[model samples]
Target: MNAPGHVLVVGASAAGLSTAEALRRKGFGGRLTLIGAEPEPPYDRPPLSKQVLSGAWEPTRAQLRTKEVLDALDAEFLLGDPAAALDVERRSVSTASGTTVSADAVVVATGITARTLPGQSGLRGVHVVRTVADSLALRSALLKARRVVVVGDGVLGAETAATARLMGLEVCVVGPQPAPMTGQLGPFVAGHLAALHTGNGVGLRTGVLLDALLSQDGAVTGVRLSDGEEVAADVVVAAIGCSPCTDWLAGSGLDLDDGVVCDAHCRAAEGVWAVGDVARWHHQGLGRLLRLENRTNATEQALAVAGNILGEDRPYLPVPYFWSDQFDVRLQVFGVPSAENTVEVVEGDPAEGRFVVRYDGPRGPVGVLGWRMPKQARLHRAGLVDHYTQPLEPTAP
Candidate 1:
């Protein structure tokens, strides 16, 4: 509570590193220990599915903290060792390597792992892009395959399909959702994305269930849909998304909903805080606990938690910004635009590869989504950060 006797951070990803920095910036010059499951130091993950998988970038290229920052902050870095369990009563944690650590305050930012297809483990040419290892595996498979089948239409899946297309590997995307990014950008914007991917030589099939993998000699060869339709493929990638890495928190007494349930200030329980995908934090605007698996949510919550630890009263309210790079088009969204609402096409055109869509709820101006027109998306993000309670003044009635 009082600048923390010692700060222990679990997970050396964006959220963990950001928390350490936020604490130091606020003059919390106490002991800082950061641990991660990966062998590498704290790094960014947004590029893992894009440039890193495309072979144009490396994981270290996405590092959020430099060696100087780590040293100056007096933070201990524990690489290749994951925090296995929390000893809440003792204010300590047990690591996978049998290491124990105790602190006055602990931040849990373990995040989530990729979800794979049901019967994909035995198949040789199957991959899921969530970590550096996953990206490397998928890249290798893409290089050797003549054709690839991608399941799920989330951000990572679409990006993988786009990367495969860039590498000249024919790709087909199968998803039950009507459009890509439907949960964030809403269905109207997602419908336009469906057209974009379809027009780009990537077969976009919506409302289909990718049930099973067809294999020959324990290697992936094709996929069978729930509709009894079989698709030929040299490789299959299941990007159905992620599951929170909170299995170890079972019976820990911390509220565990979809993730480690926390308050607006990122407080999980008595002496713990939750940040990133591992946190189900209360969003005042949405009036519910939200577990956002994105860089934006992770970084913001980390800062909020650090500040709160240092006796700050500011509650974290993220503006909600996310973007995706598929082929050459960049889709950006800024707000919680419910997919069930009516949409008003604002500017640009999806057919021309650039546009902005405004989601209209019963009260009006629920959210905004855009593709290619980055400047437009930025304007919407500014509105959100500025907390635009009402729609912008309409001109000339």
Candidate 2:
């Protein structure tokens, strides 16, 4: 494959920026342009829910790179205009601001949009943390509110609940799982996290789904559960999952399932590639299509996509990884861990608050988890690496 003379990357966040940086490092001097929906420069979003919301770190601290470093990239950054439509054949993108960009290659890194409850749009005191403005608004609401009901028990909901509790507000988490992060961490480890949250004065109302958002006078009053329970609150945070940002790619004549479906090499079509949360690529090692939303995948996948664009011809197969920080605990997971997997403590003691656990499936160890034991967990992650590296067994017809 030959290097593209010009590459246009949509969604100028971590993935797009990393792709541009990777291209430069790989000795490609092609023309590069990054288009972003947000007006701000490329910034880190992981801290927006924690440090930025907690007021421990300023909003500017979430910037992924300093001005000097970004300037050094020597790429044209088209900020504040979101991609409205894509032309897969011509490899061009039309922005919402009426700007059309054409390139020899197009990279779709639009990422995902946070899910929100019904009637959450115009309502005051209801928040979802996806951008910097969202974090600031939620923080302001938290300071003025006495009670907050986080309507989800996933990672974002749990973290937001923890931060709210730390800020001296009464916090309660409502979700359909038995415990927080049950889907991500599995039941056994999520139970420990449940205890941690309860011990820290965070309320838990799991195993129930939200019926509706209760509001009064255009402000969120609380939320109603399907079980007919109405939890009172001055503010509400909806952290329910997210969907890929493929709305712009509609009618682009490219495959769009849950995301921009791509090949093993992250190529969507001829001279077209996809990266970050918006990419659902075939994992040759796993023998299936996979999409990851974590911060790590955003950058790592970008590097792979850049290499493939420059003719590396390598499949983008990686062991999925994600980490979360809540209260004082830092949980790290390598590979996927589901609630149905059987988990075993591999190192340290669970009672000591620092241990590593391994998740096993019918075949073998599939994931490794670190409960404040990052180094040990990383060492044990080698156990799951082979599962991704080894050739998968052929499926019977």
Candidate 3:
């Protein structure tokens, strides 16, 4: 296929910016237009819950690229205007501002929005961290809050609780999981994380279902749990999860499930490719459609999509890596971590807060997790392919 004359990227964050930059690096001298819902330029999101929330870094410091670097890309940036519709047949995208932009190829990298709890809308002192503005607002609230209750036990939740505690706020984290980040790090490693949070003066309440958010005159007061217990909170931060930003493509005739469904090459249709958190592409190794929301996957997948857009028919096969920092621990993971997998200590000691653990599936070791042992994790990551290809053992019902 010939190189497209023009490419339209429907996001301005890491994935979109990476795709545009990769296209230029791949020698595609085409017209590139990057559109974003936020007025801000491309910025890093991983530090929002940590540095930004803790008042250690300003929001501008999270920029993915400087103005000089962005200008060097020579791409048109349409900021603050969100795409409302995609006319795939006409090869055009209509924004909320009622302007239609035509392109030879389109890269959907809209990413996702933070998921909110039920009855959370229009409530004061209730926050969900996703964008820079979200972090700024929550940071301001934390300064004035006395007690903060963070819902969910994912990476964002754990990070938020840590930040809140750092700001001297009495912090309590509530989640339905057995341990914080259990879904990603598994139970054994997550137990150590739970101890870490507790050691740092943060409360942890696990395996409890949140029934509703109790409010007093349009302001959040506390949360009611399924066990009929109420936890008083001056502020509530819901770090449950995020949903893909795919509502704009509702009737675009493209496959849309949890995200923009795509093939192994990240192609949704002819001239249409999806990347980043908004894309759920088929993983050749896992044999399933997987959507990764981490910063690494966003940039890595964008590069793959860019190459495919330039007529390189390569399948994207990644080792799947993500990391999180909370209190004094730095947790790094490679490959898929499943609860069904048997975990074994590979190196170091979990109690000492410097260790490496491997997740062994029915066939063999499928994942490697490191706590302050990134070097060891990288070493074990290369062996994931061999384990992934091994035949699975039969399981009892």
Candidate 4:
């Protein structure tokens, strides 16, 4: 396929900005346009839950690039105007402002929207930190809140709870998982996290479902658990999860399965490609469609998509790495970790608050996790590529 003369990138966050910048870096001199639903320029999201929420850094410090840096790319940016529809056949995107932009190729990087608790709408002190505005609002609410209930046990939820605790709020984390981050880090590693939270005076409640948000006088007062118990709270932050922002691509003739389904090369259609959290592309290693929701994957996939747009047929195969910072512990993982996998301590000791752990699948060691031991984890991560490709041993039925 010939290189496109003009490229349109939808959703100007980390993935979208990286895609446009990569096209320029890769010598694509054609016209480039980036469309964003948010009014602000691309900014770092990881810090939103940490430094920014903790009042250690200003929101402006989270920007990925300054106006001067963004302008140097020479791309037309359409901010705050979200794409309302897509005409894949005509290779055009229509914004909510009644503007239609055409391009030879389109890159979808709309990313994900945070999931909220049911009946949370119009309730005061109920927040989800997905954007700068969200973090700002939640941070403001945290200052006045004495008892904060954080829903979900994922990275975002855990991080938020940790931040709230550091800010001296009586924080309670409620989730359905047996332990925090159990799905990603497995039970053994997650046990340490549970201890970390509880040790810091953060209440950890697991294996329970959230029944409903209790509000009185248009303000959130507590959360009712499935066990018929109400946990009182002055503020509630729902870090449940996120879904891809692909509502605009409903009738675009592209496959949408939780996310914009794409091939191994991140190509959704003939001239349409998907990147970032909104993309569910075939993972060559996993032999299945996987949608990653991390900053690393977003940037890496954006670069790969840019290469594919330039006629490179490289498959987007990654080790699937992620990290989280809670309290004084920095947890990092490389490759996939499953609860069923056999976990072993590779270095250090878990009791010491620093260690390198390896998760062995049927084939071999498929993942390495570091708790305050990043250098060692990185060294072990090199072995995951080989183990990921090795055929797994069949389990007895």
Candidate 5:
């Protein structure tokens, strides 16, 4: 394969920008264009849940790069208009603003959309924290909010709850998981998170299902649980989860499962590739299809896709990584840790609010977690490399 004459990236966030940067770094002098759904330039999202929401950092501080740096790329940026359709055979995309972009190669990096609860639309005081605007809207609502109910127990939910609590608002986290991030951190470690929230004056209402949004005069007043319990709230943040932004790619002749299904090389079609949260590609090392929603995966996978686009032909198998900051705790995770995997304390002690944990799967160490002990956890992360890189027996066709 040879480098294409022009590459069109279909999203203008971290992943899309990273791809364009990687392409130029690899000596690609071809035409490059990035299509963004939002009007603003690329910015970091992790801060939206913490620094931005908590008012510790201004919205401008979240920008990924300065204007001077972005201008150096020599790329055309089509912002404020979202991609509406894709012609896979022609390697072109149509935008919501009646503009069409064609290129020798098309990279899909549309990312994911935040999931909202039923009847949340057109309702006041309901918010999500996927973008900067969302964070600002949530912060505005929090200023007048006395009680906030966060609907989810994942990283986003816990972080939002912490932000709200620190803002002097009564906060309660509602979710089906037994503890915060139970699905990602396992029971042993998530227990500490539960304690952290409780110790911070954040209420925990787990192991329950949300039935409906209780509203009065078109403003959300509270959330009703499936077990006939209701939690009053002046503001609601639905951080349940997200789905891949593939609606525009519908009927585009590409495999679309949980995301844009791709090969080991991250190629979805003849001239099409995908990166970031919207890409569910075959991980050769893991012998399965994997899609990661974390920021680290967005940039790392984009670099791999860029190399492959420039004829490197490398498979994009990587050790998944992500981090979450709530209160004073910085939780870093390497590899995939599941609630099903058994956990063992590798270093430090949980009682001291600093420790490292190892997740053991059937084959061996699958993941390493760092709770306020980033250095120790990173050292232990070396043990997971062998398990992730080991060749596995292929399944019979």
Candidate 6:
């Protein structure tokens, strides 16, 4: 495999597209092919649950509208076809159409798949908001839905519930965690979020697993709660989580625990590398290997991997960040905040639905998360570093 050889990219999300663009910018004129499972082109996914649900944005607008960019990059588009398997030994990828494309370097950007609940097989009004198709389906259902049962209170579930409430549908969220968004925001902030939703006419049930999807005549009617209870619903949306789309990498030598294991260079196993949601890449600066199921990470990791593929030596070390727009609140997060992490009120107030929480490591501020304060978060994003200390308040703007 040479520096400029046949480069096959699987998945057409942020990662794949960014990597292809980066490769071209790095002067790579290799045979490039980008494969996607969706019929639509690579689109921004954050709006699928919010603006698209409110009919403010259309599905067509979400696509990566840089056709000229891709054309100039000289990359072939293979939309709606998924990579079936990776023949790592032969350095080739097999597509669903039985087409095996031989390549010198392969970048897997297969993203993630939405996890569905048991007995939720029959779908008519039941939905998951991970893809454009899923959001479009749920938006149509919300037009007539009176109540919604959202299983899992992650950012996706919370956003869907908020959207349902905005659409005048009564919403209820059921999750196994004690508080909403605890996985990302921790207990203190999730408590405030839970309170916000419940106050806005949302029924939130924590620590309850989903039992079954109630259906009659092959159309979803309601949901049966795990603890012998039922939620009245015309729509049931499961926002449990996503599974890494590395099923095609099975038997490949790529280190796969939860996803394709890679270093900061995004090198997985042998001539193969992975990025985006399907990659668990090591960050040299952080001294830890982690995977981010975020658009920002997907873009950054893809570019960094592309640079490595083009013979650059820099390792990926980006500030992990993600955001959510729900109801009247705009949420932004930087770094991972666990339950044990010391949380301090860095700016604003939680009561006002605006605040920035700083997570302190043993040495100093390791991460910062905020809501409705883009300006502060922007400044704090640059301020945070390993062994960096942030005072309770900034030095006056």
Pairs of colliding residues, candidate 3 = none
TM-score of each: 0.94, 0.99, 0.97, 0.97, 0.98, 0.94
lDDT of 1 by residue, 1-397 (tens): 4567898999888998899988888888789999899987777888888888888986678777778867887889888998888977767888999999999988888999888788877679988888888888888878889999999888888888888888888889998887876876677777777777887899877788887899999988899888888989998888898998888777777888788999878898777998988999877665567788888877888889888988896677777778888877887777777777788767887667788877767655666777899898677555454343232334474
Top-lDDT structure, candidate number: 5
Q: Which pairs of residues collide in candidate 5?
A: none
> In terms of TM-score, which candidate is stronger, 1 or 4?
4
Collision pairs in model 4: none
Q: What lDDT tens digits, residue by residue, belong to model 3 across residues 165-269?
A: 988999999999988988887889888989899999999889997899999999999999888889999899999999999999999999999999999899999
TM-score of model 6 (CA atoms):
0.94
Query: Between 4 and 5, whose TM-score is larger?
Result: 5
RMSD (CA, angstroms), candidate 2: 0.9
Q: Which sequence of candidate numbers ranks them by lDDT, best first?
A: 5, 4, 2, 3, 6, 1
What does candidate 1 score on TM? 0.94
lDDT (Cα, tens digit) per residue for candidate 4, span 1-397: 7999999999899999999999999999999999999999999899999999999999999999999999999999999999999999899999999999999999999999999889998999999999999999999999998999999999999999999999999999999999998987899988999999999999988999899999989999999998888999999999999999999999899999999999989999999999999999988777789899998998999999999999988988888888999999998889888889999999998878889999998767889999999999999998898655433345487
Per-residue accuracy of model 6 over 114-221 as CA lDDT, tens digit each:
998787776688788888988898899899878888998899999889988988988999998888888778888888888889888999988888888888888888
| Model 2, residue 395: C-alpha shift (Å) | 2.9
Candidate 3 accuracy as TM-score:
0.97
- The number of clashing residue pairs in each candidate reads 0, 0, 0, 0, 0, 0
Instruction: Return whichever of 3 and 5 wins on lDDT.
Output: 5
* Candidate 1 global lDDT: 0.82
| Window of ten residues with lowest summed lDDT in model 4 | 386-395
Preferred candidate (lDDT higher): 3 or 4: 4
Query: Candidate 1: lDDT of 68?
Result: 85
Alpha-carbon lDDT, every model: 0.82, 0.92, 0.91, 0.93, 0.94, 0.83
Off by over 4 Å in 4: 388-397
